[model samples]
Target: MGIKIGCCGFPVSRKKYYGEFNVVELQNTFYDLPSIDWAENLRSEAPGDFEFTIKAWQVITHPASSPTWKKMRRKPRGDTSNYGFLKPSNENLEALRETVRVAEALKSKIIVLQTPPSLPYSRESVEWVREFFSKASDIAQGFILGWEPRGEWSKARELYDIIEEFGIVHIVDPFRATPHLGKGGVVYFRLHGIGGSEVNYRYKYTDDDLKRLHEIVSKYSVDREVYVLFNNVYMFDDAARFKRLINS
Candidate 1:
C-alpha cells in the first residue's frame, strides 16, 4: 500500500516507537494542559525525529458546566459556560487558539478535536464548530485541524461536510467507523479493537479487513499524505501489525 501507518503514542515512551512511524498522536492534550514546564518536559522527553499530532484538551469542547466538569474545571467556579463544557463559546474559542499555539510551539503536525460522546449532532453544535474552525484555521496556519465525532453521529454526512468545508481533517477512530474513509485532508484512524457495545464500530482488521484497507489506501495513497493510527495499544503491537501490512 506504500502508506505511513502509526499509533496514538509510543506504547510507554517515545523512544520505543521512534523509527516505527513518522507520526504519533500525543493524545494527552485531550485531557488537560498539565503545566507549561511539564508540557515542555514531555516535549524534551520525546526524540527529535518524531512528529506529533496532538488531541485538543477536552476542557475547551466539553467544559465544566456539569457536575463532572465542575470538578475538572481548570479554575473552580470559573465561568464554566465561557469554556463550553455544555457548548462552545467565545471563551472556548480562545482556549482552542491558545492550545493550538502550544502545539505549534512543539512543532506538532495537527491538532485533533474529538467531540465527546455526550455531544449530539446538533446544527447549532455543527455551526459552532464550523465557525470555531474558521477562526482556529487562521491561528493554526501551518498545522491542520482534525475532528472525530463519536457514536452514531459519526456517520452523518452533514457533520463530515462541515469538516470538509472548513478544510479540516477527520480523526477516524476504529470505535466509530463513520465511513469517512479519509475523504478529508489526511485520513486518520485509531484501532481500538473488535468488541464492545461499539464493537461493530471497532475494527480488528483481519487479513480481509487489511485487504480492504489496503485497497482504500492504494486508491488515494499517491501524492496525497495519509496517516493510519493504531489505537490498539497492546504495547505497540498494533503498530507492528500496521508496519507488516504496509510493507507486505
Candidate 2:
C-alpha cells in the first residue's frame, strides 16, 4: 500500500491547507477540549475525502506548573504539555473522555497521547498510562491511540514494549525518532527534513531526506497504514509543500 501523507495544522490556513492534504492533525484539542460543532466545522473545512486525527488534551499527559516556559523562546509554543490537560485527577480524565467522545463522533482515526520530554519511562508512569488506556480505549470505540516521545526516551526499547502491549502507535520525526526506527505496529512518520529541528518553522525536506523517507515508506507499505505528516510550517504553507512533494 502507498503510505498516506498529511500534516499537523500548525501554521496554515485551514481553507487552503486542507484542500492540498488528505489528512490534518487537530492539535489544538490537546490544549482545550472544544465543542463538537466546532470540531465538525474544522472537519467541514477540509475536503469530504480528507480525514482528521486529533491529539488528546494535554491535561492527562502534561500537567501545568512547569518552569520550562520561561526558558523557551516562544509563547504558547503549542507544546500542549505545558498546560494542565494531563493532570491525574478525575476532572482531567473526564475532559479526556469528552474529547474522545467527540473524536469518535467525527470518525477520527487516531488520538495522539503525546508525552512531554521530561516524563521519564518509570514504572509509575507506565502503570498510570496503561490504566488510562484501559479506560480511554473503552470509550474511544475503535480510535487508535498514538504517541510521540520528545527526548532521549526515543531510544529506549522498554517504552516500545509498553506501547506495543497497549497496541498504540508511535509518532516519529526523522531527526528525533530516527534512532528508534525499528519499532513495530502502527507508525506515524513526520518528515521535517534532514536537519530542520533548529529552524522549527516553515521548512521542507531535503532531497536526501526525501529519498530516505521514500525508501522507508516503500519498506513499510506491505500491511500497515503509514501516516506521514509534514511539520515545516513556512508561513502556513507546510501542507501545500507536503502535497506537492507527494503528488510530484
lDDT of candidate 2 over 1-248, digit per residue (tens): 56677766655566666656677777667656677888777667657788888877666666555553234342333445434423344555666677787786566978887767666666666666566666665666577877776654565656676565666677777555542333344568765544544236435555565666666766666766677777565423544544456567
- The best candidate in terms of TM-score: 1
TM-score of 1: 0.80
Q: State each model's CA lDDT, in order.
A: 0.64, 0.63
What is the lDDT, from 0 to 100, of the residue 125 in candidate 1?
Answer: 70
**For this target, which candidate reaches the highest lDDT against the unseen true structure?**
1
Q: What does the lDDT come to for candidate 2?
A: 0.63
For model 2, state the Cα shift of residue 99 in Å: 1.4
Q: Candidate 2 regions off by >4 Å?
A: 66-89, 178-185, 192-203, 235-248
- Per-prediction TM-score, please? 0.80, 0.78
lDDT of 2 at 201: 47
- Backbone clashes, each candidate: 2, 11
Candidate 1, residue 169: lDDT: 75
